[model samples]
Target: MINQLRVKQRDEYYSLEVESGSNLLDVLRRENYFIETPCGGRGVCGKCRVTVNGQTALACQTVIDRDMLVELQNEEKTDILMTGISVQGVLDGTHLYVMAFDIGTTTIVGYLMNGISGELLTQVSSLNPQKAYGADVISRIQYAITTDAEELRKMICGTLLELLNEAAKSVKIKTDEIALVSIVGNTAMHHLLLGIDVKSLITPPYMPKVYEAVELAMQKLFSEHTEGVVRILPNIAGFVGADTVGCLVATRFDHLKKMTLLIDIGTNGEMVLGNWQRRIACSTAAGPAFEGANIQCGMRGQKGAIDHVEVQDGKLVFHVIGGGVAKGFCGSGLLDLVASLLQIGEIDGSGRLMNGKEYRLSDTDVYLTQKDVREVQLAKAAIRAGIELLTKKIGISISKIEKVYLAGAFGNYMNPKSACLIGMIPICLLDRIEGIGNAAGEGAKLCALSKTEYEYSKILASETEFLELASLTEFQDVFVDSLKFTEENDEYL
Candidate 1:
């Protein structure tokens, strides 16, 4: 295959052999270097940039060569911090630490926090490495089913190792110093991390192999360094993972007496409806339309990504996240743009882009193609239908929702009023809506910081009832009704 290479950082040097096609990132991680390659060996994010023969190149982008010499770049000189779960007062004078890992389908966020103070020390996030295979979990599952299973595992594990190393380095500790880690993710994501086959999730049965708490030693997961234990937050059902459990915990749903709903919108949209009496959960495959994927010109919320779009004086005005030139549209920007168009009668209730003529705004072409409308239609239909079905299942009306918490990265940037115009959300719940950014991460952090919270999550997972949307007979009718926009007497807009 290939020759051995030497990698040096600080005062230590390591030798390793790699195949010719292997990238430096893979080699370094294999050697337990804890290099963070958030883009899954892709050339994006630039987090894995390193010095190779005094030249700066993305570790994931460069291939290994014979007798190559490498050094850690200036950005890579941070010390590795020990992190993980811990029981209070178990170890002698060592500082207690825990890590919360939000394993999202699109991105992963890690929080290194003190187990006692509830203070966040360091946070690290990056695109999920599995993105190289596909953007969503379903695509990744399909790839795993047809292509390579072991490779998928390697990719996921490698990405996690990078995150673990980065968090450790940021906090100036070793891997062994960390005590415990709690992770939150959807069903497919949880399955992938545990190396469980997910083919059953996509077909008729729609069953998950496990929905309870899973515990494994860190060393068992990684060969090079694994000193602590990893606790996967218990999942609710087929689609709802520990992430939803975290959302419930973060929002204190159990403490509320009134009816409430938590909707975390993403590639797979999940909603939880409950109150003091009982809690029920369901999931819908909303696709990547909202995340700026599977569209003509879509991108994630990053530099130059259009975050807001509206029509002023029959001309399009858009705001980019970094206030730079518009490169492409993000989820929030797409949602606002689509909703604005609908409000102006440019798009009908059926989501047809009208105007019947060419239009140009500020040197940029502005036109919603039939396909774009259809995409928004599908995304909105899934989310709205989910909300309606859950509310009906609980025998409550839209007005009965006392609070609605929005979770996920995109939700943090969305305009609630605009979201209502397109009927993506009910207008009555607009005032009660609050964006809770990365509740999964927060829940993970709570688990890291408190043993009580970790145990509470286990209890919550068991007590929470999961309702499979696919199995519900009235689900199709609710979905069809939700597709039509409610125009009259809506105040949330």
Candidate 2:
């Protein structure tokens, strides 16, 4: 008889019989517990620290034995991004209410709009519950394959249901009254949400199982448990999912006369390079460093997390989200902090902090360590290198690209100047950078509100040429050079 493993998550406890040698993380996942596993249970990222009988251990590395009592670590409440969803045009009072969603790896945001008046009624943001499995797409994909894809699907569906209940309650409406929901996410989230076969996404070439817009009845996902239609915008390619396509739609990439680059940086760096005449896109494995994951003292945007940093009179000044004292560094704060550190010579060209193994940010219990710098180095390199490759592919000089539309909540919160100062983006594109907050969700709203816009998304996906970043010969060399943050590599552009 297999021994039963008892897990206490938050306030609830679970009793389950597990395979004698099964992984604890896998068992926790099976029971629908959302334990933070930024490293995808590979045991590399220590974010999945859990206590077994009051002894700290990585859930992924610990196997079920002798029915141990496991306590999940306290999770940092994710400060979700909710603004920048604008409803334009007019609403039809007769039309049913619509919901638009940007399904991100780290967070999920939804907009409840009045279909008739074209007014946004309510906006809700929540951490992607699937984050318990991993922090990146590849990890999530592996989780789906290793554990159960339906498990991943249920987490998202449950999260969506919770958000819907909240939104409907906020407006004294009914969840069943929602007429449509349009979703935009990267390829992995897209596939997992629909319970689509993700084996292709994990395999070579990473081609999507399907390449067209997907429309399914909510009843299909919920199996007669809900009403309304769920329309997933078409994806540009396997890695460049509908979120990229939606971002392009949000930024009006098709109508732009000048060469524009739309960058939506998250766990994956998806960017589009094009003008009204030509368009191309690519997905880079930028990792979750920019979102404040995979770092020893990093966290998502949340209360107690440092959100910004600056140097005042040769002293470090930092701002915390929901301010009191800093607990850890969020993406924006880390960027600004790194930029300031780089500018002040605290960190060298190769991203070595001058203060030694760890540099304390302030008198608060916050610090930036050597390992943290490496995380940022890898992340910034992937994104900057992708930007460089894209520009090169478009055959345009860095200065010639007229506008850089920064999409997603990270882009909105991050200081463009800091992003440039740290070389996350070329200094030349500094003046042109513009943050389009929750642009993917907004694009989904546009799709839900208009059939014409929905059709245009298909055209945009068809026109987009997905550039495989791994195929380029110059990519490796550029990535290596981009790892430097010092002014010594001034010719990085």
Candidate 3:
């Protein structure tokens, strides 16, 4: 007979029947408990530690054998504000409705809000259209170099239009009701959207055609569709485009004193490090490993994706999102799987899949392969090296760093410990790290609502110093060194 576990919340008791071998993380998450397993259900982050009989044990790694009493710990409050405009109010009143878009490499998210109240009406997201070409910005840039530029622009624009229509449909608003639209994207994406040649971004001595703020009416660009004013966030440099500026605006970093680092992990891992004195920004081609691309059977963080994994008593246990059968892996799931495999000594520091291993997932026939480790290593190396190079270029030690804000869709799902374990982030900065979900989108929303934010974004564009990673010799060496996970004693790792 399966044992039952009871979870006591505020005036509510939920009972979950668990098999003898099931982990507490899977059972609790399945029962709709608000557990903070940011790395999905992986035990690596140590954030999901629950007191079992007054002793702490990782819920993801602990198996339920008998009836158990579980109490969830309260999570720390994040600093992000969740206020937004009402759709009906915006439609009925004279206030203009604004739409903000964060055109990420992996996912495209849109926000609809009242331009006056700054209240969020609705949020919508979908996979990026450029994903069909490749998951990373570099790949899309390469494709633009050889393929038709106009076609790429149309594809991205079409996706944006679809997202806008979807958001409007959900709130029962006309497309013309959207008075103002702001967009934030990487350099390559921004270039492609404007139908500009991006071949320069692909080669050495990368230079963007325009780096200042661009203001154009949506009717001018999308003449056949909507008639709202479209403002493309300005680019700071070749790599650091308007999205980084949007992040800066969203975080309000200019008002802070201590040195800060804003790291956005996606296909193009961009970082901005500085204080009130000055800020420096750069971009690294971190590939699509974190987005579940370039992996065997990898998929976006959608329904049916294996979003978490764990090892209990030398056995493999996993959970799929949407409570359905697993089809492939996502970024959070890949991190959890890698961390669990490492914790059990199934894989070494070099990320090699051990020979003669019997552990396998019940939902899929695929197992961790040696090549997957290499891909992950390459991705981690690019990110780590970018961080290191930026810190070094600014003449500051890692210890001097104050706060590390991780911004991105996957950033919200990452476990800081797993990220540190894999040498993707510095260990000393782990405690200071906080996840700010989709800061680019937040910045866009802020601009859509407030004129001050919109003006601030343009100021950020002019003030930030953009550093080209390709020009630095240290970046190349550090990138190569970081590829090898053999540096077990490195403090940053």
Candidate 4:
């Protein structure tokens, strides 16, 4: 049976003939409409909401049993963090133009630069299309194992070409005019971008197939897009890949004499401790809670999402993303809400809601449930435990660290006070904390600008030591201890 599906967004309408049982979410995505399915369409997150003939329904759960009129909820613009600390002193390169890419799990950002002058020409970003398969690396890896890996590779490669074309058009240049490309991402993203097998990434040792920097003919990844070479930065480990190396290069982590901690908190929490004398790196399975996955009312940072929460004059207040009614809570908002609740005695130290099973946001349908509290506990505990364990491995007290650098989007947008209050970051080091916006992207830009810096990234990757937290004997106990939402204590460190 065939059903006519009429889709309506604000002012535009799309009509398509579909099979009777076609999935609405898939249909929308096929037509190039934006909808986030962070849970891989499992219907657990409740984020994929749309209206079907005047009734609200979960897009993932809704099937086209009959001809229907579907109205998509207005999706607000997603604010992707793009700027980074400036990389000064560009050495002249041979190519007329070059492009650098930061292939993040959730987003991919590309920068077009003048190869000789290293002046930024244009920038473009797109949500990683593979997000339809899953939200995190593990979920996508499992999907690849069961399904086809080629599908993942094709999706990313197509997005890369699209970004390239968009950037070239923006700068009044042809795509073929670009001479060189540099890439950086976590291990899974690196492998997927290169179409390498990811089976090694999920095994017992959890190591990537390639740890050294690599190069490939651009034609191999994209057909006829450009006659150039693609240079990928080295991977440090399975979870920690070129993006972390990019962060290291951008921040000059290798040369810092002071004991500093660099943390990129996201779906996968990657951190490094120490400076010149000794450096140790580890990747914590922080999960996607920080990116708004798994929690009951969680969502990615987008329009209509409550990004910040506070108790103003004895009443709960929320700052929605686009000055609209609250639809859901993003990671930063979730953290702020939890911390505010803890401060007012609404939530106990063990991450329990005091008065009820859930705390409803005032004047909004959004609320945080008991299960949501546990999800925060699990996510924060992993990161806190990684921080403590990394310091233990380096044989240094947390107080001895002079500087703490928080990298990536979540790190920059999140309120530092709320982070400390929730115990995700140590309160003692709160005074030393700094937000370095998009350090990985900055590193990629540096790599594109200079051959010296690109080679230096390899040295940074080789010198840094990787600690396997799962293999550590004391990890379980420390992780359990880190689970509590207790006040910061000198003893915990």
| TM-score for each model | 0.80, 0.91, 0.77, 0.95
Ranking by TM-score: 4, 2, 1, 3
Candidate 1 lDDT tens digits, 241-264: 888888877766677797888888
Q: Judge candidate 1 at residue 7 and give its lDDT.
A: 85
- Among all candidates shown, the one with the greatest lDDT: 4
Higher-TM-score candidate of 2 and 3: 2
- Give the whole-model CA lDDT for all candidates, comma-separated: 0.73, 0.83, 0.74, 0.88
**Residue 317 lDDT (model 4):** 80
Question: Scored by Cα lDDT, where does model 1 land?
Answer: 0.73
Candidate with best TM-score? 4
Task: List per-candidate RMSD values in Å.
Answer: 7.9, 3.0, 14.2, 2.3
lDDT of 3: 0.74
lDDT minimum window of 10 residues, candidate 2: 85-94
Candidates 1 and 3 compared: the better one by lDDT is 3
Prediction 1 TM-score vs. true: 0.80
Colliding pairs, model 2 = 91-116, 91-117, 91-118, 92-116
| Candidate 4 local lDDT, 221-286, one digit each (tens) | 899765888889999998999999999999899789889999998789999998988789999999
RMSD of 2: 3.0
lDDT of 3 by residue, 8-115 (tens): 666466776778878777677556564543333434434466777567887878888878877676432222222221122112233468888888765677888777
